[model samples]
Target: MPPRPRPRPRVAVVVFPGSNCEQDVAYALNWLGLDSAYVWHGDHSLDGFGAVVLPGGFSYGDYLRCGAIARFSPIMDAVTRFARAGRPVLGICNGFQILAEAHLLPGALLRNAGLKFICRDVALRVEARCDWLDAPTGSVLHLPINHNEGNFVCDSATLDDLRADDRVIVRYCDEEGRTDGVSAPNGALDNIAGITNAARNVFGLMPHPERAVDPTVGGSDGQLVFQSLLQQFTQEVF
Candidate 1:
């Protein structure tokens, strides 16, 4: 009998000093029955994983900036290479900020509009089609967000370019669940919550989809994102 074949779409979740979601992310992937492992920041090696995820947390205690220091870790050296190679890379929350700092994408993450740390579950709408999931065009999602710097900003030209490229993903909506397609004075532009880089392989978002993998948690929309990626991985495994 031939080898069953190693898991396709293998993923590595980078674990930094203060990463609070490493295990949760690993668990989410495991629940989806996809092969995933936690990679150390100083490892400098990805072991040939097909995807990489930078989970949420105050890495280096949010010193300097959320993901600023983690970007210099040995593993990021490999991350830089993997991302540039067009492999799938997902960054959530602080991970988003780090990606921007690494120049893997445009824009910077700033403090929330109210200048206060926020920790609560929120809803997001998928505004753009993406390979991240078979997410329906107008799907609404709910997940937790805990951050002091979740604001997204970029120059006008760059913002226009990203818009032209269809890089924007999720966005925040109003009480009636309506959105104007612009970030409110609340930090995000067009209420943007997530986006992918130019290569369409690197993705980053400010919400915690992994936290909503189960319906008992009061929201199941988060599951689709992981499900879509897992399906993609399963297809690639063959």
Candidate 2:
């Protein structure tokens, strides 16, 4: 008999109590012909999943701080282990806050410099290549962002290390892909919009890539992010 076809990789989209973007992420993954399943916050295991995504939304009602309460969710333990194993993990917006709170990625997201919620499409320049984002460096991606505290901040030492190691995955940029404070919607330090862990497996960004996958609704630049992930899985690079 001919060799059997490999099963499609399955991504686990963790759903917290107030998470509103889980379905969006699932739809984007399914649109790309990949399998996706929702993992409740109370679940303790992430077995049989090829990747994990913590979608954007208000977790635990954003009490105390964004993601501060969600960090203790029962499923976070599994998510932590999955990340440590070098598996791909992508967190968006509030998801980014959760990753930071869990210490899976460096830095903390502070209130917007203007102290007002911002929701709009912004230009992002890919600063580095990683498992989650394989787009060419300096490429521009326009994605939507909606949050009150999307400003990314880190200690000076960590900032130096991130720059030296090329861990800054993306930065807010102008139409010409020039990064500066003027282009930063939330005043993120160094115009950072996204970053990856030292292993380059865990990626967290404040933009809503899930909301930009379909050209009908908006642009399709967000598809690049998911496409890169699927490529990695197809190559068995996980």
> Candidate 2's error at 123, in angstroms?
0.4
Global lDDT of each model?
0.81, 0.93
Give the CA lDDT, 0 to 100, for residue 169 in model 2. Answer: 95
Cand. 1 Cα-lDDT: 0.81
Q: Please write out the lDDT profile of model 1 over residues 1-238, one tens digit for every residue.
A: 9977665767899998988888878878887777798898989898669789899898899888778888888899899999898878889888888888888878888888889888888777777766664676566777788888988888899889888988888778754466775344347766878888877888888988888886675476778878878777767743
Residue range 38-117, candidate 2, lDDT tens digits = 99999999999999999999999999999999999999999999999999999999999999999999999999999999
Model 1 clash count equals 7
Tell me which residue pairs clash in candidate 1.
Answer: 181-190, 182-190, 182-191, 183-188, 183-189, 183-190, 183-191
Candidate 2 has a TM-score of 0.97
The estimated TM-scores of all candidates read 0.91, 0.97
State which candidate has the highest lDDT.
2
**Candidate 2 global CA lDDT score:** 0.93
